[model samples]
Target: MELQKGAFYLIEDIDPEKIFTAEDFSDEQRMIESMVADFTQNEIIPNLEEIDHQKEGLSRSLLAKAGELGLLSADVPEEYEGGEMGKISSAIITENISAGGSFSVSFSAHTGIGSLPIVLFGTEEQKKRYLPDLATGRKIAAYALTEPMAGSDALAAKTKAVLTEDGKYYVLNGEKIFITNASFADVFVVYAKIDGEKFTAFIVDRDTPGFSIGPEEKKLGIKGSSTCSLIFEDAKVPVENLLGEIGKGHVIAFNILNIGRYKLGLGSVGLSKSAISYATKYALERQQFGIPIAKFGMIQNKLAQMAAKTYASESLIYRLVGNIEEALHGKVDGREIGAAIEEYAVECSISKVHCSESLAYVTDEAVQIYGGYGYTQEFPAERMYRDARINRIFEGTNEVNRLIIPATLLRLGMKGQLPLLQAAQDLAGQLISLQVKTSSGGEVPLEVEFDMLNRAKKLFLLIGGTAAQKYMKKLAKEQEIIEIMANMCIEIYAMESALLRAKKALAKDAASAETKIELAMAYIYDAFPKLENWAKQAIAYMFESNEEVRTNLSIAKRLSKYQPINIIDIRQKIAKKVLEAGKYVV
Candidate 1:
């Protein structure tokens, strides 16, 4: 695949900062997260083998235990016997519980995509009848949206839902594949075609005639979570079972997937951190040639990169979560939730792509760090590596997510956010000031750096502007590349934004002088070289054949005045803090 200059440039300028301090979490949120983590460590970890090996179904006893702790109720409303913790807190709980192997998939599905539809779109009677039981894990909920013919093209569902002549019920006939909780679900939110033209969602009970599950398919990972196909052979569903307005199933499906994407990212972040910790611990203890493997330069480089990427993922996910919270501060009704969530499609998609891909990189390196043992089932890295692979594929594949990010941004651009253009201007100004301060060095031509940065900025603006104009109306069709670019830009912007915030915080805090100084130095030391390289590469690729642009790349490379510090040492300091905190802190 050809590199998109705009996307590559965005990836190049990532800066490190303490944007996500632990202070952002509420005491209750932290407490719940701790409770979930403890539950996973104490209750679930010891029984992973049983859950993984049990063929009859999920361990009923374990599900009951989780329900007792209220782990299954975070997303449901309090009136329905749920915690009503909102997405951020629910995400924290999901992420922490993910440490319990395949059971996390079961837990997240029960709380998120499976039950969110009823809470958001079901009628009052529907909520009363189902939420209480679903929340308490007395019943399991499943969402059936993807069919054999409609995986990525989900709206093209062929399943039929025909209304009875007297309008008493709908006769549903469809098969949904790869449902997470299908084998054990008591209630299912199923979507099917209506009158050959419209799609609608229905809540079908497991006891309904013709509602049956296919044999569980052996899967690549998440073995403990039941995976099967749901078959509805002329299943009779009451009119009251319709999730929302007829033909509005698309709204529920898409919006729920958006939330699912964010939750998936959050879970991936936790797993990535776990992978890093396992690798680092192994590196510190395992010796080669009479010394610890971590003492080797290449091994240290891998560790540093994993830590840096994990930090970046941590910073981005929490920031996105905060944005969502701010967007939905006073809104409580389900009608308002859709619009509120639609506001964050871009950020949610970016977070999904960033965290998932980061975990892929981190986990792969973790296995490498463990050498041969990492590839064995005896070690956790092997399982983590396998489980981590699904994040990028499911929950709207990363390829699909790439499209959503940029397309949403472009659509927003037409509405005047125009993030790429604004960000480019800000970056150009920063480059100009950096140039002016270093003009006296004469080591590299300042004019060349200015020319390269400006050209690269212009190219980014041009591509973004073109996409916005062309796909302003058909946002979904062109969402893939648009998402890829948007994700890249958000990461770059976030890194720079965090650096600025950290710089200001350091300047104001007198008591944190020593710590602040190290953070500030680390940001500059790590960010500048990468930013310069990114600008140069972006410019070179955009105008490679143009002599004027091609000739300026050498000048951009030589402009850096600061010497390269040992990034390994800097990252070790960061990793130590992360380890001590038992999570990414700052």
Candidate 2:
């Protein structure tokens, strides 16, 4: 059951039987999920306003309660007074807790970037000292990485940590802006350059003299989460507190970021589901022209799209989690887990980009469904809209993640891990012969959709492979083309995940799984034209010679073309399901 390190597999290597879908949850998982749901409704929702206002001691109190309930320890080792639950269990906890509005951001940062650096990089002594308190929520955690000067170019941080002549302590001096949980965190995973050149990570306690928290920053949303600047003026951190190897902090930083990215995706899905529920309930209760707004076709469109997007997000997030868990199976060492995560860097970026964008889309539609009231501070839709905006920006901006997707794909291609070049050559041969290869999934439903998905993958290869050959080591400068390739990959992954889940559902109950099928179909149909448009843009950028443009355009048209579905009817059916359940059904 353990995955071998240094082994990479292509999509063809994946077994359909082993692919985990949302419905694969065990009763035990469901119980934990229900516990989180109850806690969110009873504990978090009631205290929303207080949390939003940054009430003194309130977030910590709630976090302590979460710790008491063992909510904060899912990923920690059992020996560290933790749950030692697998990735799936931890992911479910994160997804359920995301319904808590701004509080979820605080929770995510604390568990993810805040504590994971230690969990995945700390020495035995460090873990023994910090993991127990963090697992029990006796001490709050925060991540300090973003500096005033170092935003996207994280390595350009001006913060410096110099070891004393005796080498017993590192005298750190720097300021980190936008440190989540800054106002209340008792411990920080601080990143700085050692001796002014080597990037490193240090565990700095809040009570350390000369370490101070600046005033909280006002924000667009997620106001309940503490955000402040961390000022370190010659703060002395014990040399033993350095995490991982010196000059290898990027190992801890990047791997922990991958964890944050995927978890952010899951949390986005949770928020999307919550937004759909809020919008649907509002639509059902609010009347327009003496009838519930849910009866209106226009309103139905938004509701259906929101539900479909949420379904897609949920499917992909869970599927990705399953992969990560399988990859890390039987591996408990911090470095091993980090390497396993780093192996799926491309998939992590895809999930982060797709799910966050999906949430943004759903929340926007949720606001639109609420009409004028949605624009006001009094409505939940407005808050959801504002809160959802940050997902696309944080954990790495979607733009940065988009770039990472294609870059990672190309890197994998160069390493012979993805068969990208071979696939592209095959695709080109087929295109020249006018022979189209369709997906073959025996006895599977939605064969046409799956076939289209196959073609989409080919289109991604055709465009991406051509771009790579044409640019030839200079493609990094072609940001737009990279973005297009990334978009194709994102859509391909989303469509695949949704299709696989729907196929699984159909196998279990063909008639009852209608909604799942519709959602999958809707996502594919919606993505087709967008993918084509992206292709057109990429093609335009790739070639200036008329013959080259014409030839590629023809190939793009053929690969991107698909028969459109009666999406309006599907939406009506889907919206009916949402309206009936008063939430996202899938």
Candidate 3:
């Protein structure tokens, strides 16, 4: 197999000119972002109480309103009366609309997992029948994959379907729980097993006979989005409604998740920006002692960290989206697009894990900055705190995604798709020669960080190669070590992305990139130590020999040692910028 051509394996030679960053978004994308931001602030935020209360028809009405603006159609094709815009446009909509909170959940449910199955795996007839209405939000869509017994183990679905005597329909029987958009969804992309063996996907209409929606589940977060179970008792779905091929349901299910994960990460970035703004404004107004609380070092620390992580998350999201778009360029066919998205599954998982965790941190700190007010329902910080918690559990739990990062990388390496073993062998030779170059000594802006990224990758390769050699085929069972290495990989990606984005901005105009440069530096100065510790842990775990472990730890230390930038100055400067701007401007 050829090398996996993505961020994970394609780490050696990335051109800043070619790498996409948020600063590189097209004019049309900026327009779309502004429009969605207006809608979110003007329409959605003001109606939060009503939406959260599950007001009758309010959520659906808002979704229809978005449809009129073509917000619901970004990922659809022109022939189907859809927007036909690129994925970046679609991502912008998802990112900015997140300020709407729960309503964003409803909107994404309708446009993403709910409708993407048909958009990507549906037959031509299926696409024609569903895409037009779905694109316009005339028919809301939902995905039914989580059954009562199969949350993580989705393929072990108890939902059974069998063709009827005439073979025109398949009778289904099962329950799907925790479904988004369930209360108002007009169509559903459901998964069921045939003959208790062959798992398959089906497109079921809301009014299908014997199909019933369960009572709405009272949720902890995203309260405005509908969450209910679906009961399919002898429900008859047309044979033509089947999505993709029988026994290939996992293909559609996982591929849809690849896109979902990245979009979710982008949504996290949007919300983090909002949280920073909310917290910063509150701190400026709230008094402490003789001056505003914003003057406090602790508050400044939180603000700086939030903005830094958000910057990193935003950078990685765009980078990942750019890769998907490049792979998907000119591919109009649904299956082809699905295949393209599946190619970057590892990067998608990284985005999901890193961004979601970043949002969790930002929201938690926002509440901290808000102090007592943050805990109250009167402020958005409390709500944001609640809302951000579900993302880790959503898409796939961070644990599952963490395992996926390494598992997929190693799997590809073993299958010859990624030259992991070969690269590890080369690095091993370097370890013997102690030829690991730690510092670049480059004096240019962010060149230190560029050097830091290279060292981080070398550390990952070092720890990973040792682990693979020690465990061979059984590395998967060492969950602790694998997760530690996964965190290493995640940090490497975050550092590289932030570095690239800031560099791209500097290349355009160095004077204008101070905040971006500081953000990248702040994040790297803060994150590299964590990476170093993880590398140390992996080195310690995989090696029983003290001398070998000592050797690897020394290499890790050399790789980690760099001229530390003014971290205090960096964070304080970032915090002051956000405080002055009242949001994450850079």
Candidate 4:
């Protein structure tokens, strides 16, 4: 699973090693997945409207019940009375709960963003004080970093904190907007500039003096989750509550979000899976011209497209999890864990942007499949459509994440963390001559896709090198090229991930891997051309001469050349499987 250390991202060696996938889950993990799915479907789905209305404080009660079941403690250390399950199990919990709608949003905030700060950055005293209660659902937790003056620019927050004269407390004064779980959370991980200079984090209690939550906000989605503003006027926080270190709040704030972004991808995939289920069931039952709509080729095409995209998204997410877990090597300490996860921050952002966009596409098609009912609130497709829109905005906007992908890689190159520039230079000489690893997977499937994927990497390097050379120090400011290169990087990761999973399925001797193979082929068929077009755009932007543009496009055309797979036939196979199961089978 050595997927080219850090931001180099499988650019060089084609190591189709034994990567992790959903099929690789242990028996315990499968049971946990089953248990979570049961809880979400039986308890949360049936009571969704009541929960959506926040009736009788039902959302809070349900969260507490989840805590009692130890679902909320997957990432917490065992010393604090937590389940201490690893990343795979936590991903299962995150993925399975997504169909519960806004309750999943609330659940994710509490378990992931809210409580994880303490688990990952808090000191010994802080963990002992907060983890037990949070782990047991005896208390709720929230994270507040977004301020009115700052949205994406989080480090520029206007919130201020001044040390008390007695040195016992820090007085906080400012406002934080869009605070999730604000209405019921007992603890908050808040960030403020110390003495209006040093940015820092503090664990502020709900009972702190002058600490108040504003009225609930009206939002388009995730309505069941409480979103509000935090007003702090001379609010007193104990000095012991200081998280991480002074002037290093970015370490905690930014690093925690790395985990959040990956989890967002996992949740998006889960919700996409749900959308498939909803659409498949509807297509099967709904009749048109006295026949099931599932019989229509158009509807089947949509279902197949949805399943293939989701397969790619799911593949990339679990592949990322395997890499991160291997990097951590089972460490539970605070800084060590944060730093390890931080190492793969680029991959996480890729997961965030790609999967969220995939969810948006999946949900939209789901609504279209439902015809008139999808627009009305009477069907789940409408709610799913509304809910899916927010993921592209969460964990940082897709635009921001896209910029981060290339920018981070460039930074790593400058710092000599990864030999990105060197690889680009070396690849330039070998672009056309670079041979695909036919013997790589050892008599396995997707050999054609394997070649396309290898060529895709070279194509990315050629354009990336051109962009870097042309823009030089000003590459980050070249937002358009930056985003184009980022999308290329994302597609490269996605193509490899799906290919690896298909190989893994056959490697594991699955009873049936036809659909997995078809999914990989179908996705690669669609993604490779998009990669070439993106490369052509970047080339045209970088070079003004038409000859240079033509030359580059010619190179890309050769690199992207492949016998197009029969996507319609493959999609029909995928749709047959999905419609028969009435869910995302592969």
Q: What is the TM-score of each candidate against the true structure?
A: 0.83, 0.96, 0.97, 0.97
What's model 4's lDDT at 264? 95
CA shift at 128, candidate 2, in angstroms? 0.7
What lDDT score belongs to each candidate, Candidate 1 first?
A: 0.70, 0.86, 0.88, 0.89
Across 499-574, the per-residue lDDT of candidate 2 in tens digits comes to: 8889878878888778899998887788878988888888887789989999989988888777666899999999
Clash pairs of candidate 4? none
Candidate 4 residues lying further than 4 Å off, grouped into runs, are 1-4, 432-444
| Residues 1-586, model 3: lDDT tens digits | 1223664533474767777888887888999999999988888999999999999999999999899999999988899989988888999999999989899999988898998889888889999999999999898999999988788678889999999999999999999999999999999999999878899999999999989999999889999899999999899999999999999899999999888899999999999999999999999999989899999998999899999999999998998888888888878676787778878998999999999999999999999999998999999999999989999988888999999988888888888878877777787566565534335555576666776787778788888888888897899899998998789888888888888888888889988888889899989989998878898888888888999889888888987777765699889998888888988879
lDDT of 1: 0.70
Clashing residue pairs in candidate 2, if any?
none
lDDT of model 2 at position 259: 92
lDDT per residue as tens, model 1, 1-586: 1111122333243222423333357899899888988998898888887777754655556776888888888878899898888767877887788788788888888788999999888888999999999888899888888889888778888899989999988898888999988888888989988886788888999999878899887877788888899888988888889888888888888889988888888888888878877887787789999998877778766766676666556656766665566666678676688777777776677778878888999899989989899999899889888888889887888877776666655555455644554654454355445432333354432223233333334434544544444455664565443543454355454344334334434555644433333343354455445545544554554453677465545434544444445655776676555445544345
| Model 1 misplacement above 4 A | 1-21, 55-57, 416-459, 466-484, 493-566, 575-586
